[model samples]
Target: MLKVVVTGPLAVGKTTFVSTVSEIKSRHTEERMTQAGALVDQLDGYRADGEAAKTHTTVGTDFGRLTLDERMVLYLFGSPGQQRFRVLWDDLVRGALGVLVLVDTSRLEAAFEVMDMVEAADVPYAVGVNRFPTSPVHSLGSVRAALDLSPGTPLISVDARDRDECLDALIAMTRHVLAPLESV
Candidate 1:
């Protein structure tokens, strides 16, 4: 089994992205961390489903499993985004194959910290721009410039709520992680 961790800044669509692609139901541990800041986290045009209710905070993490094909089974770990919970990153990434760093174009800088953490851990990763319906469209070049990524880094736009888009992002990450071997 391959461990895959999805991480990003608060409300970057990590949970939604996982839910879209996972064959098994994605487990969510989200609870309202702060009632006062509820308005701040809202994604402009995005809202949770009717059945969704804020818990308190994701004290631990969200877990899910996805079967990419007959040969690979992916276990996904969704880590909380707030800096206060950053201490959990090491544990969550312990055996991860690679990470999917989701970013919101409106808050592109929010992904910098997460990217730094993953790079420090020496894990291969790909960046996914989670596009919000209300967000202004930005070219891939502009997004790459904002992230300051290397030319070889994979950067793709994804609708975190769309299954196919999420899968495409994961596939891109997988290819990145295996590129060295694929070229051999």
Candidate 2:
């Protein structure tokens, strides 16, 4: 099975994305948010009511599986988004075929660190702009420019709540990562 890592900033919907696409029950290491914890966590734009909008956060990794065909199955590992959990990134990405870095347009800046970690891991990656209802609708070109993505990098819009959309994004990343080997 091919491994893929799903990473992004806090509350960017990594858990939801995995759950929506997984054929089986996905494993999550989520914990309920506390008032004290919310003060330290970045809760802006997640909800109008702040911490109330986000009741749970991923304390560890999220895991899911999707079988593409008889020959191909993807094992998805979702790394926790908070900076404190950055140490887990190396292990999560060690053997990953590719990575799907979900981004919240409302907080584009938060994505830089995640992207850096992915790049440091030296894995092929695609950027998926997870559009929340309150998120601004930026053009793909503009986002690419903002993220400083290479021309060949795959950048697509994705709805974390939608299974088909998430699947398509995964396919795009897989295709991009595998393209070179296919040529040989």
Q: Name the candidate that leads on TM-score.
A: 2
lDDT, candidates in the order shown: 0.82, 0.89
**Pairs of residues at least 3 apart in sequence or in different chains that clash in candidate 1:** 31-55, 31-56, 32-56
What's model 2's overall lDDT?
A: 0.89
Local lDDT at 154 for model 2: 100
Compared with the true structure, what per-residue lDDT tens digits does model 1 show for residues 1-184?
9999999987777887777777887888877557675655544443333234444445568888898679989998888877777899999999899999998877787788888998899999999998876566899999999899999889999998888898899999989999998788
lDDT of 2 by residue, 1-184 (tens): 9999999999888999999999999999999888888667887648622334888889889999999899989999988988878778788889899999999888899999888888888899999999888788899999999999999999999999899999999999999999999999
Span of 10 residues, lowest total lDDT, candidate 1 = 42-51
Q: Quick one: best lDDT, which candidate?
A: 2
List of clashing residue pairs for candidate 2: none
* lDDT score, candidate 1: 0.82
Give the clash count for model 2: 0
